[model samples]
Target: MSESEAGRITIDTSRPHPARVYDWWLGGKDNYPVDEELARKILAADGTAVRGARANRRFMHRAVRTAAEAGIRQFLDIGTGIPTEPNLHQVAQGAAPESRVVYADNDPIVLRHAEALLKGSAEGSTDYVHADVRDPDTILRLAGESLDFGRPVALSLVALTHYLGDEDDVYGLIERYVARLAPGSHLILSQVTQDLSPEGVARAAELFRRSGTPFYPRTLTEFARFFDGLELLGPGVIPVYGWRPDPEDVAAQAEGVVPVYAGVARKP
Candidate 1:
């Protein structure tokens, strides 16, 4: 919240936003009626929506913890949704008290809840950047104030890439961000995929498109392309729940299939 540029923030309740829709799926109360409507519609078409959201959250926690345990002390999380409990900062700082985190999101609602995200352990520092993921320069520049790019940092974009279509140069944007990181830095990502349930995923994509949000559900090979030059960690590019699952993730796997691909890689 402290890094936000001064301006009047506005919440557009007319159309559904991906972050708010995701919040609704996560059982958070920060979304509007339009967001809830879309979330319910997508859930009706794709029964795994809620489970996928939850699994993605777990994947993020596990990934951040892994990085923290590996001695990474700086984190940059883009497309950070609503202020969910045990957020990226909490998970990272929990593993390493001195972990520094910077969260970036374009949603006004997220900005309003930035104060909650800023509360980290006394040994660590947390900052929020009110910016879009497409503008990597702005985010990196502002986040640099708190994170040292000269050293290893963990960059996470969980359940976010699917919202950007091919026209957005998703891979190129990711490359730009990765190029700024030092060696040994980690890149954590989780994306919605159609490899598990093609029919349901297609229907869900259509629903999102009609609601004015562009959605792209990639196949396994396509999703794996995101880790091109990086070294993938163990359990490479598997289903969401299968990526270093904890007890919670183990139980979730028995519930249903979450057509999402998650992976963590290190810049060697």
Candidate 2:
């Protein structure tokens, strides 16, 4: 239930998985009934659970565009859930066709769909690693096969960090990966926060805890620490939909009460 075997993948439908449940929220068919069951429970607790999930994915799109437009050609994405359209590669390679991407996830389902993620541009490279975020050494080692650590890279951890509680040393773990990057390297992170829907988020967290899943939403201060030593990008640490939002939606969704906070930071 914690981690899947490397070569042998067996999905357990008895309990809910964070990735699968998230897939359900994203309207993907990669999830099971168990995932939907838990997802419903969460949705019942938080009315905007589905909305927040979609918003989070949009954040990924915008963030990747920002990175690509900034000339960051290498991308390392951890906790990559089911392969939805406009994936990291599609967006990054769309902007810069030569962009290389490495996707990592411990979920067996993600590995099963690795083929879809591997389809990168001929001018670029795409690879998937069956690993967990906690194992940064392995992730970085395998991802290095395609990406050049000597150059600027964008390390993206989208809608994923809240799974690691304080005891997991979220700050130290992230520091390990950022430490390996050269200057100008970027960190793209978006995580859920209780700032907007405190009560709803708390109830949802309790539900996840009872389901044997660890969900930890942090305060703005704690979340900002994850980007220490890096210069935060514009609209720093605001709601996921609020960061450099599209002109049309900026005023409308700007004040939208979403539960996630996103930010991009440069290593320099």
Candidate 3:
């Protein structure tokens, strides 16, 4: 995959990284022992950790497909964890072969596996940016090389914001990113919430905090605020599995409720 100059890539196995922990939850082997340790701890605290990770992946697939079917060819996905199969670009290009996609993440391991993410349809283009979500300027500037902000681009940050604390200005950060999108662009988001399983979510957050990664599980009202000036689609801001579920998602719902809220909104 083509990448912007992000300086020397480094992987610190000394501590657990959110991306590595997420990869471990998704059953990927790219994570270190530290990541698996935290993943197991969180799973032990919350039985739905594995299910929640899978649900978020499915939600991303559906959301990207929805945007692609609606004629949004350009995509910018920040906080991309790892090179999972049927990733954002795969889903987008599956709907429209000419789709252009840019993936941004701070994880060095993701960059190491980025070559796998670049195997897209010949009709489309895929690029990766080794950057963090907190640095919107770098992400936007690098992604702009592959995507046109003048057109309707699909911006996705699925299951990512919960990792950012209030000091990160999460809401303001989202606004800054959204402000760059053109009219008809789509903003896709999914976040961890305590509204569904309060106790379990609380325990999980505590575990994350203890590991030096601050977690913020928002309530429904707080989560809804992220879509402030956009037009929410049908079944707006509901549980991850309930947002236009396919047969697979329908069966997943029977597994039990996952404490995550997801929504897709159009920039008017």
Candidate 4:
């Protein structure tokens, strides 16, 4: 576990963390040698790994915009990884300046960089909660301070659930989080799946396991189950790069075979 003191989180550079490694992948400078080592190893094993990360970020941009355009003005993004450009609040507030966002993550590095996530449009509000995804109740309680549970909230779990194995009772965690939202709330998710590259993805998962970070890439059907009891949006459960691909992003279009599955659904 990392050390924490007086609201200043001290990170453990001795090991690799998911959020920091993800930061490295996004070309952020917050990662350590351990993180870079793991990232490089995964990149070496799966040529599409880095591209998959970038594609997921692009999907986040499009999905946030979609929710905003649909009149949703609140966001609760858990496992918010590390702050890459166009963070959730930035995208949401850009479209709707009054949009409120609450970001939750367990990583100390993310907490250290929480300041950037806090900067939202003057009219909007952004707050960070340092908590693990497993504790949905704490997240909901703390987030309640900023968001209104009586209104639709775009709950984002992008590129997060694959870390949770079946034993983790992943569905229960998701359901608990969703159950707190008012009707019309949305669930946005993206997870790595071996459907496209079984061997390579499994190898990467083992590497993560050895590094003490669990990675479980679910199948397409398993990934879709996350949206159970919710109304799925059209063009559902497709590759991250395939969802609302930008014509201007020629590379995203060319890389339509990204191994991550993503979808957005609304609570009935």
Task: Report the Cα lDDT for candidate 1.
Answer: 0.94
TM-score of each: 0.98, 0.95, 0.97, 0.96
Backbone clashes in model 3, listed as residue pairs: none
* Top of the candidates by lDDT: 1
lDDT of all the models against the reference?
Answer: 0.94, 0.89, 0.92, 0.89
Clashes of each: 0, 0, 0, 0
Q: List the residue pairs that clash in candidate 4.
A: none
Which model, 1 or 2, shows the larger lDDT?
1
Which tens-of-lDDT digit does each residue in 1-268 have in candidate 4? 1235316766889999998888888898989999999999998887788888888888899999999999999999999988888999999999999999999999987887788889999999999899999999889999999999999999999999999987889998899999899998989999999998888898899999999998899999999999989999878999787787776445766754568999999999
Worst 10 residues of 4 by lDDT: 1-10
Candidate 1's TM-score reads 0.98
The digit string of per-residue lDDT tens for model 3 on 1-268 reads 3445333566789999999999999889999989999999999999999999999999999999899988999999998988889888899999999999999888889888888888888999999888889999999999998899999999999999999878999999999999999999999999999999999999999999999998999999999999999999988999999999999999999999899999999999
Off by over 4 Å in 2: 1-7, 247-256
lDDT, candidate 2, equals 0.89
Model 3 per-residue lDDT at 179: 97
TM-score of 2: 0.95
The superposed Cα distance between candidate 4 and the true structure at residue 41, in angstroms, equals: 0.5
Which segments of candidate 3 are over 4 A away from where they belong? 1-7
lDDT of 2 at 82: 89
Considering only N, C-alpha and C atoms within 3 Å, which residue pairs clash in candidate 1?
none
